[model samples]
Target: MLTFSIFAVLIGLLAINVPVVAAIGLTSVIFFALLGQGSFLAMLPHRMYFGTTGFTLLAIPFFILAGNLMNTGGITRRIFRFAGAMVGHIPGGLGQVNIVASVIFSGMSGSAVADAAGLGQIEHKAMVDDGYDPVVSASLVAASSVIGPVIPPSIPFVLYGAITGVSVARLFMAGFLPGIIMSLGMMAALAVLAKRRNYPCSACRTPAREAWASFRGAFWALMAPVIIIGGIMTGFFTPTEASVAVCIYAAILGFAYRDLKLRDLPGILFASLHQSVSLLFIIAAANFFGWLIIHQKIPDKIIAGLVALGASQAHVLLIMMAVVLLLGCFIEGNAIFLITLPIFMPVAKIFGIDLINFGVVMTLLIMIGNLTPPVGMCLFAVDSYAKVGILPLSREVLPYLAVIFAVTLLIAFVPGIALFLPRLVMGGM
Candidate 1:
């Protein structure tokens, strides 16, 4: 009961629009007082500092910088153009292009907001100019952006692995098949919608020269994910090292493409800094909060309660997913992982669930929240990029959202959908 009440208080603080840092830190402080452990207050400062000192966490800022750099540079446009040449001949022309572009960008950015806001402006204008509905364009972009974190080189996977001690390499490999499933699923749905809505399609194949030109144009930009993931898989770089390398690579591409100027770098650096600071602060505060939760053995009590309900491994997972899905709608995605994983992990152990599969499924569920209502970040990004109303985008996004959620649940139950590649290459299940 005390454990659950801490959730209520923390959530209540968040619901009232408290800063995440303050809300989490305050929750920990308040709980310590209530528990009559006033001395814990003295430990808060050190604990917060301690949490931020991990070397692995250096990946977060560099990845954010890489995403912002790619978004600002010419890379997004080239990637989109490459995707269009490959897939624009499909029914619903640019809709398929949109998904393909997002899939490719996902491998690099690993962030839904970057995909929506970066490629979004170009995708919307192309689709709308080519006579697609604003609602459809906005919604498709929002739905497809969910793929950003599910693919390799995912930032969310990094956060998950960091929090849970799972192998980040395995997590990256785990994303391959699930990412393909998401792409094929959305593209299939777009095909049906194209026919039903009579979306324009290119009547002839893209010229061989044009296709080759696009692939060549995007070759370096495309190589970002390949180099990063390849380096990690081959043990040449840790995830943190990969982030720094990608940042340098992204800057080179920016300059080489001639779209980014020396003067523009300050703005990109400031944006990345601002974003990274807020994220890292939440991580620190949440770490302090989580330490208190563990110290209190709240997870144990929660696990006992669930077991008392006779929940099996699958049932506990389903219950946790439902909780995460609900929480994702209200909270930021990484914060959702930071807050919930401490509780859910112990429950997972008691139920004999595998951590890698759990990481993949949990990351998917959190990203899905970015496509949902009210606070869905990608929805807002798409709306701002296209000026389409959120309500309509929300409605049109339903089919893709439903399909991906079902696919996520499918992965959760099967495990092999995610674990297969990791097992095949890394030799562990």
Candidate 2:
């Protein structure tokens, strides 16, 4: 009854348009009050503080700052040029560049919305002028943006690690192979679609020397992720330290390249702080909500209930994935992760699942939500940028979705795909 009441209050508040953070806090308060544990409310401040005060959590702000610094420092143009040089001769030339840029930018930003907002601008205009369907272009951009969180330095992984007690470094390593596989899968899907439609290729091949020049120009920008991942895997630094290292690296590169200016620091700092605060509040609220779940012994009850139903671990996992997908259609990714992971991670552990593999799978699944309807941040970001509607964009994203789902299933069944690299680097899980 208490559990039902918690969900009822939460869902009711959500239906009436209350903010997720507020809804979570209010529901938690109600649950405790009803259970005659009103004194639990006194612990709320400590829970909130501890939630955001982790050393690992420090990485979030640094990463956001580094990404914003790179953006203000003109790294995007370099990345675009390098992508153009590499793939501009293909059928659907600019579309291919969009995906390539996403794969590259994903390494640095680890944000789908940032990828969509930054890369979409250049790729969308190019595709439109090149005669590609505007809606399709927008959809492709949105889908490609998923690569951001799948790649290294992913913010989602950071949140997942903090919540699940998994190694953020291992999660970073585990994501690489799956991320590349997903990118290739999307590329192959695009190729098939392009061939079927007879999309136009670039009129001129990039000159060999010019392509080399562009690659050289973008080499430093490309190497940022390598430094971060390599340092972490080599035990040269923790994830938090690596984030600081990246910030310093980004700042140096920006100044040396004369792309980042003194004037930009204030804006970059403010933006990072704003984003960090918003995300931290959600994390804090989630901490209290998660505490209530524990106080209520929800995980044990859930496990017993599932056992009575004769559900296997795999069956439970599949059901959870389906629910996540459905919720992704309505809620933001961070909100979903904060609200659900605390509940699901316990269930996952009962099944002998590796938290690393679960982290990768969960990240990918949430990314799928970003491409779906209603609250798909990537979809809205790309569509708004391209000046297109969500319905048309959704239609155009079907093929991409098919490719994404295939990759997700592969990761689901073949844990090695996500685990192999981490094992190799970390010397076994």
Model 1 over residues 213-245: C-alpha lDDT tens digits?
A: 999999999999899889988899998899899
Task: State how far residue 128 of model 1 sits from its true place (Å).
Answer: 1.2
lDDT of 1 at 305: 87
Q: Which stretches of candidate 1 lie over 4 Å from their true place?
A: none
Query: All candidates' lDDT scores?
Result: 0.88, 0.86
Model 1 clash pairs are none
Estimate, for each residue in 224-307, the C-alpha lDDT of model 2 and write its tens digit.
989998898889999888889988988998898898999989988998899889889999998999999987988788878888
Candidate 1 residue 282 Cα shift, in angstroms, is 0.6
Root-mean-square deviation (CA) per prediction: 1.2, 1.5
List candidate 2 stretches off by more than 4 Å.
Answer: none
